[model samples]
Every structure is written in structure tokens, then in C-alpha cells.
Target: MRRLAILMLLPLAACSSSAGEGTASTPAPPPTSPQAPAQPRDLTTNLAVPWAVAFLPSGDALVTERDSARVLRVTPQGQATPIGKVPGVAAAGEGGLMGIAVSPTFAQDRFIYLHFTASDDNRVVRFRYDNGIGPLQPIVTGIPKGDNHNGGRIAFGPDKYLYIATGETYKTHLAQDKKSLGGKILRVTPTGEPAPGNPFGSRVWTYGHRNVQGLAWDDQGRMYATEFGQNTYDEINRIEKGKNYGWPEVEGVGGKPEYTDPLLTWSTDEASPSGLAYAKGSLWAAALRGERLWQIPLTADGEAARPVPHFQDRYGRLRAAVQAPDGTLWITTSNKDGRGDPAQGDDRILTLPLP
Candidate 1:
């Protein structure tokens, strides 16, 4: 509840240049595997258990490590520096330092937002970094958390609202609870107040989600989310206000009439959909258990095509995939940090140039 002074990092104009050009508005072709397109010339490697990656106003990238609780400043030249450590982070089985996003008004106020597990709950906090004085202070808190289903992803919508993703944390019914901020997308003002004009009158934007981990917006202002399913299916949903994504009631793509079905769903073994990003008019999803990058072409409406796998064995256990400031897709490997088999470099971030 402590109010902290805000600091800005990069200006809006600085971000517009890199962001507006990288992702295209045209429809992308479906991914083909039997004959993988020749790998792009630029494929930068070396990152570790990178839970999330955010682009700074200055065009650099901020990458987070789930188990390390460390926030790294990754440069365009591929050099990474430890910016600062996150506080109140509880690390363990699939729980730890999770998702991160830069404030929309980063130029005027260098505020950084983060989602991580605390001792008792998973919460969102905003802080400022000034080099000498590490992390500034807490911006928000009081989110529910558990070992397995702790959804921790945050992004800024085009309207500049901060959208937070959360999980039910084993409490299946919590997803449908309006009062509780769990298993749903939450919309809030930059300062953490419930955003005005929210569908539920509360922070809840949509409900009935299991463990939503990734979120992104297209040029057309459409929102897409990637979710981890319980047993059968993993989903890529085109999110709408007030809609419920079937969770405990129905596993993945199909569910009750009242709930909205996913735009694309993959079997559990094929995709444990985690991090997501929109690049070149297509949605790219990172899979943990599947260990591949699923490139999903979207129709103008935002419904995703059957996913096309990219870099299946080349990259180990893809965790986070974000469009970088350089117009290239930044992907993080999660083989290290104790989850998947540790690839020599285990947790490393890679850059893939887009066409």
C-alpha cells in the first residue's frame, strides 16, 4: 500500500518506431515443418529459464528468470546485465519470479511491472530502478497464489491499461468468483486502481481460466491469450470482455454454451502454452512440455490457425517469446532452472529475425 514516486525509462516515440514496424497487419502463411524454412541468418542464443521479456523505451529488452528472481537487461548486442533483484518472490515448483512488463508511460515514469509468487500469494508489484538505489517500492499486491496454477503475466493494453493474468491455484471455483482476483484477466489503471468501464465493475475482465500465462494485442486492438490446460488441451483464446473461458467445467477448446471456446487448442502433450507474442500479424506461443515455438496465424478476427511448430529441437523448452525492440522475436530457453533437462546454457535468450 505504499505509494512510490515514478520514474520513466524510454519515451513513447522511441517505442513506436520499433514496435509499429516489426509486426505486420497482413495475414501470415501457415507454418510448414516437413520442409522447415531456412533458419533466419540472425539467431542469437544464450538465456536461462527466462520467464518473461519486455522491451524498454530505449529499445533494449528486460528478461526475467523464474528461479533466479533476477531481472536482466539484455542489450541488442546480446550482452546482459543484472539490473536488480525482485523482492518478496517465493520460488519453487513452477512458482517464482514470473512475468514482467514496462509501464506504458515509461518515458515520463520509468516504472516496471512484475508478477511473482510471494510466501502466501501471487501478487503484482511496480518499481523504479535508478542504478544506485536498486528496487524502489511496491506498487500493488494481494493476489492469490499456489504451487501449481499461479498465473503470472502482465501487459499494457493499447488504452494504456495494465492487464494481469492469474490462475485458480487449485481452487477451481475461484475462476468464476468476481470478488476474488484469480483465474481471470484483470484490468487496472497504471496505478493499480480498477480500470474504469470494466465489464464486472471489478478488476476482472474475463473469467473461467485455469492458468493463463501469456497475453498480447494485435495492431487491430484484438487481445489474445495463451492458457495452460489441466489435462487434455492447451488453448490460445481470443479474449473478449465478460466472456468465460471454460476451465474445470470443460478442459480446452470445447466447453459449455455460455463459455467462449478457444480459437486454437493443442493436446496437453503437444503444448503447455506459456508465453505469447504477436509478430508479423501472427501469434507466436512458447511451449514448455512441448519444447517448441507454435506460430499461429490469425484471421483478422484474431481466431488462431492450427499452430505451426518452429525450432522444435533446436531450442530446448521454450518458455517466453516476446517481440523485441529490433523487430525480431526474442525467445527464452527454459531447460535450466530445474524444470527441463538443462541444456549446456540451460536458460538463455535467443533472437530470431522476422521476414
Candidate 2:
């Protein structure tokens, strides 16, 4: 494991002018230079179907393997040790052990949350994960599941609430139906109760989603999500509390007044976007079918500019893109996930410089 020092980017401070009398105003700082292109470094190469990674305060990480139902504790040097197996995980097409998130208060709580496919449906469970494994405590359950479209990205938001992203389960109408948890992003307490002040007085936060595979928050505390489109386009959306993103009703952009149009969209082949991370005034989206990493520059007001693609077709089918606690980005490849052709060490974690 090679260690690199990262330089933090600073914004220019506002300059104030004194009242006249030969008083000169100070000049604003020069524009910051673009970072040198990040060279991808292989952290680990011998992993099987690794999906999501969550970093601990100690700088160690917890990684999830989708098909194996295994949770691994990885050091910064990329040494992986099996912590324990999640009980009763039902691995099917596009499902299994999907997303893992550590508790924000993990030092005291010692809790880690997992979203996975079960025999009957998809669910979120929290476990007391000390260095040793403990019992799995079910939190949110009964999310509709299917062979595909089981949206399984879970994270704790800036509000300290747990957010679960769920797919519509191949049923288009579920996206528009407010009653079902399918095709919606849910906000709940750590104990799995509905968060207070939720729209419709339930756990559902936003509705009308086809399949949302990513959840991220920018520095401003604004939430963002990535969506998988049917055939025409894939999407990145700015998520609001009760807003509905047009899924079944509209695919990409709809001028319709009822639903919120996506902030950005890409061709289906160009972006089957999965995990996303907001860092350095941009959102980095990991593409699976497109097999690229996209960086979307953001304006000061939080509006998105055109996206710039990096490492196109360089790494095969990028699965997850996350900013580690150390301020560098870590990404995983998914060529071994029964989709694309796998290369030698097809499934490996790669580290990149901060955006």
C-alpha cells in the first residue's frame, strides 16, 4: 500500500475595500489550479464480488461482498480479514449483500447497518459489530424485491437519520404509488421508526424512483442520488424531502409540473451509474455498464454543470466510488459480477487522488 499526501483546496476569501482616500482594495486570490490527473493504484486484487465500503474512524474499513454474504474488515494497507457472515442472505441476480454503512455514533453504539436480499424481500438490519460479531437485529423490512431492481444503497444522512434507497421491483406503478416502500427513498430512525416530519406521515422520503443505487450529501447538506434508466438515459437527481422524481411517468426530463426533473442525465450505454460521492465541489459517479468514472462540476449555488468523464473504458465496469476519511477516493470494479468479461484480478479496489 503506497501512501500519498493530499493537498486541500481552499477558496478565495472575499476582499473588502476601505472608504476612498487613496485606499486600495486587496486583490482576491488567483484561481486554484486543476489537480494533476489521479493515477489509479490497486489497493487489493484478490476479492470476490466486493460492493460497498465504509471507513471507520480508526481509518480501517468495512467492506461488503455481494454474493458471498461476507463482511470484511480492511486496513488502510488493503489487508482484509473476514469478520463474520451475515445470516440468511439470499443471493440472487443483482441482489444479496448489497450496501453497508457504519453508525455515525459507532464509537459508543458499535453498530453497523446492512441492506441485503432475504428469502422473502429486501431488508435493512443493524448488528452490534465489535471486533467480534453479534446478533443481527432487523430494522426496516418488507421492502419489495425481485430478481433485479432491488435498489440497495443505505447511508446515514447529515440529519443523522438513516436513509434507505429501494427499487420499484420491476413494477413501474410502484414508483408512483406512495403507499409502497418500493421505488422510494426512505428516512427512518436508527431503530427503524419513521422519522418525524416526513412527508405523508410515513417513513418514505421521496417517491417515483426506478432504481436508485446511490445516496450522497454535498458539503451544503443537500442530498443527491443516482438513478438507473430503462434504456434511453440514466440520471443523477437532487433529492428533496417530499419531492417526487418522475420514474414511470417520465424517464429523463419531463417538463411536467408534477415531478422534479433530473439535474443530469446520460445515455444508457454511457452510464449505468451506481455509487456516487461528493467531494471537492463535484459529484463523482461510478458507471457499471458504461465502465467509466464521471465528474460533474458544481456551481457555487449547488447547480450542476456538464459532467466530464475520466478513465473511460480504462477500468472495467466501475461499481462503487467513495471518498475515504483520509480525503482520497476509493473505487471498486465489478467486471466479475456476471456482467462483463473479467480480466486478471478483475475485481479489485483502486485508489485515486481527491478530486
Per residue, candidate 2 scores C-alpha lDDT tens digits across 71-123 of 88988788889998889899988889999998999999999999999999999
| Model 1 lDDT, residue 151, Cα | 87
The Cα RMSD in angstroms, rounded to one decimal, for candidate 2 relative to the true structure is: 12.2
lDDT of each candidate versus the true structure: 0.74, 0.82
Which pairs clash inside model 2?
none
> lDDT tens digits, residues 138-217, model 1?
54577778767788889999989999999887788998787888889999998888899999788889998988989999
Error of 1 at 274 (Å): 0.8
Whole-model lDDT, model 1: 0.74
List the candidate 1 regions with Cα displacement exceeding 4 Å.
1-47, 132-136
Provide the lDDT at 132 for model 2: 59
